[model samples]
Target chain A: MSRYHTSRSSSTTPVIILYDTPGHSPQPWAPNIWRIRFILNYKRLRYRTQWVEFQDIEATLRSIGAPPSSVRSDGRPVYTLPVIVDPTRNSSRPEIISGPSNIAEYMETFYPARPVFPEGSRAVQSLFVHYIQEVFAKPLLPIMVPLSAKGLPPRSQPPFSHSHAADALPPGPHRERAWQLVKEQFDFLSSILDKNVQDGDGVCVMGHSVSYADFALCSVLLWIENMAPHDGWARIREWNGGRWVRLREKCREYMDVY
Target chain B: MSRYHTSRSSSTTPVIILYDTPGHSPQPWAPNIWRIRFILNYKRLRYRTQWVEFQDIEATLRSIGAPPSSVRSDGRPVYTLPVIVDPTRNSSRPEIISGPSNIAEYMETFYPARPVFPEGSRAVQSLFVHYIQEVFAKPLLPIMVPLSAKGLPPRSQPPFSHSHAADALPPGPHRERAWQLVKEQFDFLSSILDKNVQDGDGVCVMGHSVSYADFALCSVLLWIENMAPHDGWARIREWNGGRWVRLREKCREYMDVY
Candidate 1:
């Protein structure tokens, strides 16, 4: 253990297992899982990643007693794409940690080196997360169902609808609207990025050093660059090249391998 | 002053200031702001809330020397409400924490009597935050924009469509799509809640106890319920009356006021 561990509770290390989706349909989300992996990588912790076939997610969840299938009538909405198991939290049964924020925080407890959040970045990071949720993620809904269909090949997820649910999926009329909204969303993000880039700040909103906001921003941005309809994500494209490139590079380097 | 100071960094009784936009006008996002205030109240922290006029946000941003009016070509983002000033992180300059997840974490740092994350809830919280951003918040976007100028006055201040100009307000054709998409989003959230409700955890996915996820979900749920077309927020409505009400109440009492 390093000096950061000097302040930790004990000498024992934690065991973490990540159950990730195998396909490229962006089951839960690529950037979402990537960021978790990045944080794990950043911690340099030894962990394991078990890629689950989307079809088998139900069985896998049931077998581990990690949010079994019977829990939902609609088959557990976006059911646990990234589930973590740690020995530290539950010595008796090996607790299962689900969700991205949970995984990141878990890593912070046992390992705090190369911090994702600065001493005072709690709010900044949280806002970034919210921005992604509210702005970035909002417009992505229409394409999600198509993305979740495992039968579709990666990049072959779904075609863009001119209006709501033009295709025969869920009959949910949010597709055309999502497409329309994503344009506005892209503009909003570009505007925000313009502020950050002009700020003379190294990365994101907080200025100088990159915080969790930077990482979280990076995740959404990666998705935007890949998915959104903004033909010229010019401002965002440049922003990504700056701090994001370095952040993800670090996340990859720091990813803990089980 | 409070027994909650786990970090032992400051002795001057940290202060948390919230910048709020009141009365559901300028946008009916009361639940988002309420969520932050509730946490502060529950943490038992004495904090001040200043209702912000959207027009004045840019001036405040400039005064604070944060990312200023430069956000747009000339003004601020349309509605960047809820600016938190926490003195604990940096003594000279306040930690500018905004957005819900960010604010919640900020609250946790100062008032952790009952942590938002359970024993080994680190990873789960991270994932929750990610999903909220990518999934939950994304779905809510459709209903947030008003149907027309008619809905603006009651919901927001004047110059509704032109306030920031950057938003190109009314969200245009996108708003209609967004509204239609609302049902689909609900369908997804309902599924998640349906499954989790049966898990019998009585807590969020992050831990054995209710974590920030609970608070965050309630805030969004309430927001969605308010924006929803009908009184059919069945799952969330039932939840609020059942268990969420109490958990939310506890979070409000965490008063670590400065």
Candidate 2:
């Protein structure tokens, strides 16, 4: 496994453990988890990855007393990965943070240098991230979720396959419509990026520097590249005048898998 | 009519004319037009209002040699209001700029002192505005369109009344569902604003300073208040812990009616 040492001067050992679920591929693939990974790498924080199987996610999170990320329809708690355990804050007791937003906030508070949210941009950046997930990514779920499930390891495949059975769109009009919706979202985002063309490459969402919004977007691109590199990534890379390809390249430095 | 003069030192007279449609109420009611009005007032640009009837919008625009904002499906050009004619750009030939985005950009380019897009924020701010219009204001359209049509002047009433006839949502479950969707959007926006609570009142979409995003949102709030004051604005003002009320108050300075 690849590891990154802390660049910051710290007397103690770097013990920030990021809990992630492994896919079939050697590299990490989940978009939500990739958000934190991007932030960790961007901040150049020293952290280690603890891979847990999808089946063991609940038990693993419960053992560490991390709160449930969400609740299922049946009123049961639904545990999710991308939880971080940071002993740097307190050596005796590591702070366990669940949920991507919470973890991001914790990291930003602890590691102030190279902030993910630039000056006075937390609210707007959060809105951008919300738009990416709720509007942009919502249309892609039916197409991507099933593809993503198929890319998981055999032990982790059963749960995702069963849960996302209804999410599969057969290769026909329905799937085409799904892809068309994804394209429209991409077009809208591309237009937003176009405004920044005068400044530079128009890769990062905010200004010239990389922010959480870029990480949030690039994480999805990474997911698409990881899961459906042949079809999905091929189409997306060419869309919006190759904006996504440039964005992925712009964010390539932070994609160090650990 | 209320008139605002330029605070800047200009030897020549202010000759910026904004084309807008007037409602039955003395105040301006159109949300799209309000966006420009907010910018003009915020920038403190000296401008005159040329009230255009809804039916006269096309003829008025055509008279000024302004291009059509869009084309109807039947191949006919569709003209819209909130077009600005600035003689300051050229003495012999005035520059007639249509569309809110274009007008805002023009204003920012010329009047760079008080920028609506604060430092490399043009792209993300535009995305915020897009989200407000395409997503947040969409469900409110079916509910607000018919109500807005009723509030227009008699000459302007016919076109809106007929055009939005099918957009009316009667008092029933469907209307309730529309409001619920609006509430959900408001909730999402409120959460974004909540991130700024520690900073201040959490009124502005950005930091403490008001920007174009605030104008876009406040324009919608003004629409609800103007069209459906009792039911729509009443409910919205109370929702999300009086967030909309605070935003409207925050932007009240820019709500000049001229």
Candidate 3:
């Protein structure tokens, strides 16, 4: 199968285009998109953001002839957000990589100087990212998605309802139950962060310098701050003995688009 | 409350006593205990092992006045295995550290030269261990426990059944269902390990040397290898391009008890 790449430009150094979800306002709420953005900024790679509306993700991906990074349990292709078109690296044609981990791997291979995996720590760091994406993010989904739905543009609301209606947290008391779950997950995370204070400089998630693992975590935190500040990040920023706050501060510079 | 330390002698450098669960044969199958054993050997710390049967766990712990590492969701204390009594490190009164993470922290604080939370990677390393213990190990419980029960001593079998009867994987098709869950978890792990080969030496889980993260993973691998070699470990040892076998070889030195 041919790989998908964006249309080329005049410059020798091809600019990479990042596709992100556009929320109620201008910023992106999805953690997966923020993950790629964090890596791009961290590696000092030049990139531009293309704000795709929620309802248009599948269509936009298919129109570009980009392959989905993964498939559903039943083997159906899952065309998700956070696909990137890195034109200069890999091939003469701009290379489009789908999914957060896939894009991170591509960036790491092409930009080895600005290392995210870090020496021999790749295996564990990958595991850390996997946990953040799969296990750590599970509880926050219920709380974050519904609150995020409130900020969605009217055009995007229908698809959000259609896709996530059953999975989204219900209003009223169930919200409290979901919050309880969120707290439980944070409590576990807090205990883990406490180890940093005891062992290291207590700043970044991995080593003194930032890595992909930190980006993976900070993305989740950013999602909370962006999508549901009152419902989630507000409480988390203060909890865990301000570990969350310090973590964001450590990675705060990378949040900026280059 | 006062901490419980194992009865000790007058040596200048005090020895630590590790509590582990003994299987039917002369081997340890519990991942949590294997975790501490790995740390003790990695640090080259002088320690002795005390094998406790499953039936005797509560009574033995209570007799020693050892505090349970954690409580259940309902708030009752959980008298689990893998507690360590470390002497001559922190206080004149030896410290009794319970649980894998707790003991690992004690070792790191005392033995900084042979580091587990390498450089400034404590937070990420801690999260990695947490995920292994909490998330990655969840699906294996059902598959491991019932199979492991067959290997437990005759005296230890009843209480193993009593305490874990409801949760143990049932006979026949339920066992198949458990194996299915186990395979799914391994598939996720194999993807993570594939990154190591792509990025680093593809042996250790974390940085160059075998750190605590490797121990955490190896502990699970060892549990499978010892508990149900044919049923569980055989399938995984070859999967993910032999990531598990290479991981075990990387940490093989630590598997030997002092």
lDDT of each: 0.51, 0.84, 0.76
Which structure is stronger by DockQ: 1 or 3? 3
Model 3 stretches astray by more than 4 angstroms: A1-13, A73-76, A90-92, A161-172, B1-14, B73-76, B90-92, B161-177
> Each prediction's DockQ?
0.04, 0.60, 0.60
lDDT of 2 by residue, A134-220 (tens): 888988888888887788788777676557453667778887888899999999888888886655357788889889999999999
TM-score (0 to 1) of chain B for each candidate: 0.62, 0.91, 0.86
Query: Least lDDT summed over 10 consecutive residues: which range in candidate 3 chain B?
Result: B1-10
Error of 3 at B2 (Å): 36
- Local accuracy of candidate 2 as per-residue lDDT tens digits, B1-258: 233443333546756888998888877888889999999889887777888877788888998888788788999987887799998768688888888998998898888778888777888888889889988898898888888888878777766655745367877899889899999989988888887665445788878889999999999998899889987998898898898888888888887755
Residue-wise C-alpha lDDT for candidate 1, range B1-258, written one tens digit per residue: 112333322436665677765443333345557567557655556566665555566577557654321256566453365667776567687877656656776567567765664432333344455566566577454344332222333545465665432242254666556544655654444444433342224334322344555666666655554444243244444532355444434444442322
Interface root-mean-square deviation of model 1 in angstroms is 12.7
Model 3: residue B99 alpha-carbon error in angstroms: 1.8
Query: Candidate 1 clash total?
Result: 49
Of candidates 2 and 1, the better by lDDT: 2
Interface RMSDs of the predictions, in order, are 12.7, 1.8, 2.1
Model 3 chain A poorest 10 in a row by lDDT:
A1-10
Q: Give the distance in Å from residue B149's predicted Cα in candidate 1 to where it truly belongs.
A: 19
